[model samples]
Target: MIQITRTIAIDEGELDESFVRSAGPGGQNVNKLSTAVQLRFDVRNSPSLPEGVRSRLERLAGRRLTRDGVIVILAQRFRTQERNREDARERLIALIREAAVPQAPRVVTRTPFSEKRKRRDEKARRSKTKSLRTGPIHHD
Candidate 1:
């Protein structure tokens, strides 16, 4: 079981991993060995996650989430399958942990009166300066 938080624990069976060949840094070994790990988790059907976390995870997963509600994580940073697997699992955990945290409510704030006045004054000053740059108005 993967413990995401004090309240959330996902079963090991929830995760599915597949190995594939990785590109970059491994040289000849990269061509021969399947070092990349593709980890998949079904967000829609997971019994472990809270509904809020599930929604947040779906948003966070973005393009990684399939139409069927599976999150696909590809890990190829390491040159060994074990390392890639670990990396994938760690990434999943991190993502889930992030989703578990509640977002802080945004406070609606108005512009300060002094700041607004200062901006207006600056704009007025700029307009006056630009107006002065023009030649004196002439009446026909």
Candidate 2:
């Protein structure tokens, strides 16, 4: 089972992993070893996630979520397939955890009266400075 948070946990079966050759470092062994991990999870079909959480996950996933509603994550940072797989799984868990939390609604705030007055005073000062730069009009 993969635990996203205290409230959310997904079955291990929900995660699918694929291993491919890693591109960076590792000398000749890099060509022969399939150390990279590709992890896939179907957000739409998962029975564990609430509809609200699933929707949020889709939005939070960005490019990771495919058109078919599958979330794919690739991990190639580690040199061994097991480490890469673990890394991918951990990333998926982190994503799910982030999505599962409800965001607090932002409270709209009004500018303080003092702040408004200060801004107005600043503008007035600027206007006065600019006006003083002009030569007095000759009334002849």
Candidate 3:
């Protein structure tokens, strides 16, 4: 079982991993060994995640999530397949943990009186400076 958090754990069977040839500084190993790990998690079909977490995960996944609601994480940073696989799993857990936490709602606030006054004073100063740069008004 893959534990995302204390409350959330997904069975190993749920995660699908595919190996593909990696392109990098692996020399001949890059061509021969499929080191890259493609981790696919079906967010829409997962019984482990809560509805809110699934929705947030979908949004966070962005281009990584397919139309079928599968989140694909490509792990190619490591040369070894095992390391890459571990990296991908860690990333998946981290992403889900992030989704699990509810985001604090932002509260709208009005500008303070002192702040408004300061802004007005700055604008007045700028206008006065610009007026000084211009030639004095002449009465014909």
Candidate 4:
């Protein structure tokens, strides 16, 4: 099981891994070896995630989330399959951990009276400064 948090643990079976040839530094070996790791996790159907977390994960997955609600993460930074696999898993874990955290509700606040007054005062001061720059005003 992959422990995402103190309360969330996902089974290893939930993850599907596929290897494909990665286009990066590896000399001639890059052409022959499938070092890239593609990790898939079905967030919508997974029993491991709570409803809130599942929704958040789906949002966080962005373009990586497929039409079927599978999150596909590609890890090709490393040249070896083992390293790439680990990278993919670590990324998944991080993503899950991020989703697991509950977002705090934004507290709506009104602008302080003092602040509004201060802004108005500044605007008036600027207007005065500009007014003084002009020639003596007549009965125009």
Candidate 5:
């Protein structure tokens, strides 16, 4: 079981890991070993996540989310499968943890009349300054 957060924990079986050839630095071993780890997690089907978290996760995934609501994370920064696997899992956990947090709704705010007046005053001041400079560059 993987503990994503204090309130959310995922079963170990929920994660799907596949190994593929890494294009990252590995010298000659890059050609022979599959060090890259591709981690897939089904966001739509997972029972571990709350509905709110699932929706947020799908949106947060961006290009990583597939058409079927699967998030594919590729970890190839490391040259070893173990490290790549750990990296992939860590990224997945981080993503899930982020989704678990509820986003505060934005509050609509209006500019105060005084603040607006101040801004207008600054704009008028700058405009007058520029207009004064345009009268003449050469004076006897």
Candidate 6:
């Protein structure tokens, strides 16, 4: 079980890991060994997450989430499979933890009366200055 928060724990069986050959630093070993870890978690089908958290997780996952709602995390920063696996797990936990936190409601604020007045005054002043740039009107 992976504990995401005091209330949220995900079963280890829920995570699916696949290994692939990584593209850097290992030289000849890179060609032979599969060091990259691709971690997939089904956000839509998970029983561990609350509805709100699941929605937020899907939104946060963005491009990482597949059409069927599986989140794929690729961890290839490390050259070893163990380190990459750990990195992938850590990233999943971090993402879930972030989704668990409730977002503060945005407070809609109106423009202050003084600020509105100042803007109107500035516009009037600009209009007056531009008006003065024109030559005097002549009547035929």
Better of 4 and 5 by lDDT: 5
Model 6 per-residue lDDT tens digits across residues 1-140: 99999999999999999999998567788999999999999999999999999999999998999999999999999889999999999999999999999899999999999999999999999999999999989999
TM-score of each: 0.91, 0.90, 0.90, 0.92, 0.86, 0.93
Off by over 4 Å in 5: 126-140
Which one wins on lDDT?
Answer: 6
lDDT of 1 at 16: 92
- Give residue 50's lDDT in candidate 3 (0 to 100): 90
The list of candidate 6 runs beyond 4 A from truth reads 136-140
Overall lDDT per candidate, in order of appearance: 0.94, 0.91, 0.93, 0.94, 0.96, 0.96
Candidate achieving the largest TM-score:
6
In model 4, residue pairs whose N, Cα or C atoms come closer than 3 Å (at least 3 residues apart or on different chains), thus clashing, are none
Residue 46 C-alpha lDDT in model 6: 99
Give per-residue CA lDDT, model 2, range 10-85, as digits (tens): 9999988888889956789899988899999999999999998999999999999999999999999878888888
| Candidate 1 clashes between residue pairs 3 or more apart in a chain or in different chains | none
The sequence of per-residue lDDT tens digits that candidate 1 reaches over residues 51-124 is: 99999999999999999999999999988889899999999999999999999999999999999999999999
Tens digit of lDDT per residue, candidate 3, span 57-86?
999989999999999999999999999999
Shift of residue 138 alpha carbon in model 2, Å: 6.2
Question: Can you give the lDDT of residue 26 in candidate 3?
Answer: 86
TM-score of 3: 0.90
Choose 1 or 2, whichever is better by lDDT.
1
User: Which digits, one per residue and each the tens of the lDDT, describe model 5 over residues 4-44?
Assistant: 89989999898999999999989999999999999999999
| Colliding pairs, model 6 | none
lDDT of 4 at 127: 100
